[model samples]
Target: MVNNSRTNPSSDTISYLELLQEILNKKNNLLGFAGVGLVLGLLIVFTTPKEYQSSSFILLEPEGNVNSFGQMGTLAGLAGINISQLPTSQMALTSDIFPDVIHSRDFLIEISKEEFEFESKSGQIQTLGDYYFKQRPGNIVKKTINYIISIPGIVSGWFAKSDPLPSILAKSDEDQSDYLKLTSQELIAIGELKKRILLEQKGKLVHLNVEMPEPLIAAKVNTMVLERLIDYVTAYKVGRQQRNVEFIEQRVKETEQKFNEAQMRLASFRDSNQGLISQSARTREEQLQFEFN
Candidate 1:
């Protein structure tokens, strides 16, 4: 009789219905938070101001003779000259020069003036009476009145006390100047106005590609960059050519001088030897015969 009945342990566990209810309660709390968030988001969106934006794109290309050095070497070899010591590339496109030219201070100044026109104005007041006596009884009174009323700060401050003309003008000038400087710097730093500019070297081809945000600007900038690059390269090559021409002219002049001296020496030797044959005469004879042949 002392309780021989066995208890079923699994029956003591919480039922699925209770667990489902607890989970549903958490879900409801989460839904409430989401609803509040939605309302706040809608309020913010309706209150915010809208903004519009415009953008441009550009592309860049390589300028000038890409194979000039190689071509020059071949030409030199054909001319029977040793040009191995000559530089393969010119200095026109040096890394520092391009950016400096593009972002030059003078250029930015010009652009600023073109973009922003500034004007200054002054205000004046006129009054008539005995001109002086009606205003003040004596010189001392007149002087005090003039000091207090005619002086810039005293009269203008009292008259147009809240005028912001001076500050506005100053701010406008500063902003315009700063804008020009920043734009120029950005152009220089970004070089070619491209989305990206790429350079790579292969066995035969040296590849360059540039991309920009605006198609027309991209094309124009790309073309201009290429043109400038070419101009720099061409100028560099032409400079080298001019230097070579100078060297050749100098050499030719020296050779002519030597030839004249040799001729004079030969004449003097012939006269001293009474027209006798000499080694130099024989050499000259051989040179003439070679030229004729």
Candidate 2:
């Protein structure tokens, strides 16, 4: 039998020197690519609007802390109002559901409808929804890319008259529903908004962040968002407390009915045994007394 073996030891492996030489050989191409990349990066940086961020957060008291309302009581004393003796809300917004309150569509929609002074519009005040629709916030590259990508849809839209989606709030009917139907502009505004705003919770404190093209606008929007969050939290807590009060009242009614039944049973036993003297009557009276007690 004959054996034949073939092998290449340095097959596809490059030495350190050879790799350096190869890179040197393509010096011009690398430099050209680097220059093009730098140019593109610079263009992106220049075309993008500088955003300013404003941040705020609320420090909540410890859960189920009865002493947390001390400050409220103090304030009430100043106003000659005795809320200290009044009932306080037993329910609170928990950390688990806190994020939902911040990111909810209804919460965001309220913020979008708020009017703010725009520097880009020469001090003319406009709602966030309208501004987003009219001034489409994005860098030039994004707008160009979007325009190119949407060419087919835009062309089709030209041939076919398209109607805008209806807003739930804009409806003139007396009917109201739990679900929301956002208009095209509101949807666009919300999309832009979700990008500019952020919310995070650490322990009991919840932080809110808002970013905008202008400094004043960022601060204003941040304040508004915080205010809305506080209002929503207060309303939620109040509603929960009201429900708790109702539950307690129901329990109280049931207890009263049981007490009345016990009293009636005891009274009937005494009346029926008035003329009878028997061990059974004594035993029955004792049983009824035990139950009443």
lDDT of 1 by residue, 190-293 (tens): 33222244434443344444443234433444455445555755687678766865554565566566667767666665566566487877776556444333
* Residue 226 local lDDT, model 2: 84
lDDT, residue 99, model 2: 61
**Global lDDT scores for all candidate models:** 0.47, 0.76
Question: Which portions of model 2 show Cα errors greater than 4 Å?
Answer: 1-32, 65-92, 159-176
Model 1 spans with C-alpha error above 4 angstroms: 1-195, 275-293
Candidate 1 — number of clashing residue pairs? 11
Assess candidate 1 and give its TM-score to the true structure.
0.35
Backbone clashes under 3 angstroms, per model: 11, 0
User: Candidate 2's error at 119, in angstroms?
Assistant: 2.9
Q: Candidate 2 — what's its lDDT?
A: 0.76
Error of 2 at 54 (Å): 1.0
